[model samples]
Target: MNRSYEIMFIVRPDVEEADLDKLIEGLTGNIVSGGGEVKAAEKMGRRRLAYTVRKFNDGFYVLLHVLAEGGLITEIERRLRVQEQVIKFITVRMDEEEKRLAKVKALRDSKVKRSALPAVEAVAEAPAAAEPAAAV
Candidate 1:
């Protein structure tokens, strides 16, 4: 059975971009070779850490969406643990309900629909005498 996961990892800021690329490439390769498929990945540029980690105050963040077997995920986590450059990481498994909700959210996020009523009308009905605002 295939399972979906959202993985986020933080790496030390001092690490070079090439090294970071190698780490991500290595892990993704491992996932595919171990029977998994990567869906989406986003690199959230380096930023200050909430609290110091390994005596550092900032780290680079990366997020990945992937589908894989259960056992492969365990190995992925294990590989992350042994890396000196990784400060912290998290993986969230999507259950049936969560997966359904994610699909709904994706659809909603991509839409471009305007409401029939203006903001004020939607919030509260005005007196019958009030005139509609002039169009821009």
Candidate 2:
């Protein structure tokens, strides 16, 4: 079954913008050819790393949101591992997180819609208590 994923990778800082674009295209191409869908691709630009990785202090950051099966993700990870320009990378599965967020939002919406009238009524009647006790 397909699932949501976010793959972020850091490439060497010295790489050219053109090369970076090519690399991103290649990865996204792989996903499409592998029967996965590329939902989004973002280049967050170069920035300092919290700590050194592969002896590099900063790198170009890229984020990808995709939907694919587990096997395809594994393959993509393998490709990233072998790409010399990439210094660090991580893959996170977001399906569960998305589902949880949706559930919370639905519950919140239902509660708000259900009690909206009551909340308005309470607010309208709060002036008596909100008064400063007639200046004590």
| Residue-pair clashes per candidate | 0, 0
Candidate 1: lDDT of 102? 92
Cand. 1 Cα-lDDT:
0.83
> Which digits, one per residue and each the tens of the lDDT, describe model 2 over residues 1-136?
9999999999999999999999999999999999999999999988999999989999999999999999999999999999999989999999999999999888766655645555466876445543433333
Stretches of candidate 2 above 4 Å error? 119-136
Per-model CA lDDT versus the true structure: 0.83, 0.90
In candidate 1, residue 125 scores what lDDT?
39
Top lDDT model: 2
- Candidate 1 ranges with C-alpha deviation above 4 Å: 95-97, 102-136
How well does each candidate superpose onto the true structure, as a TM-score? 0.72, 0.88
Give me the candidate number with maximum TM-score: 2
Model 1 poorest 10 in a row by lDDT? 127-136
Per-residue alpha-carbon lDDT of candidate 1 for residues 15-108, written as tens digits (9 for 90 to 100): 9999999999999999999999988878898999899888999999998898998999999999999999998999999767687999877755
Task: Tell me the deviation in Å of residue 53 in model 1.
Answer: 1.3
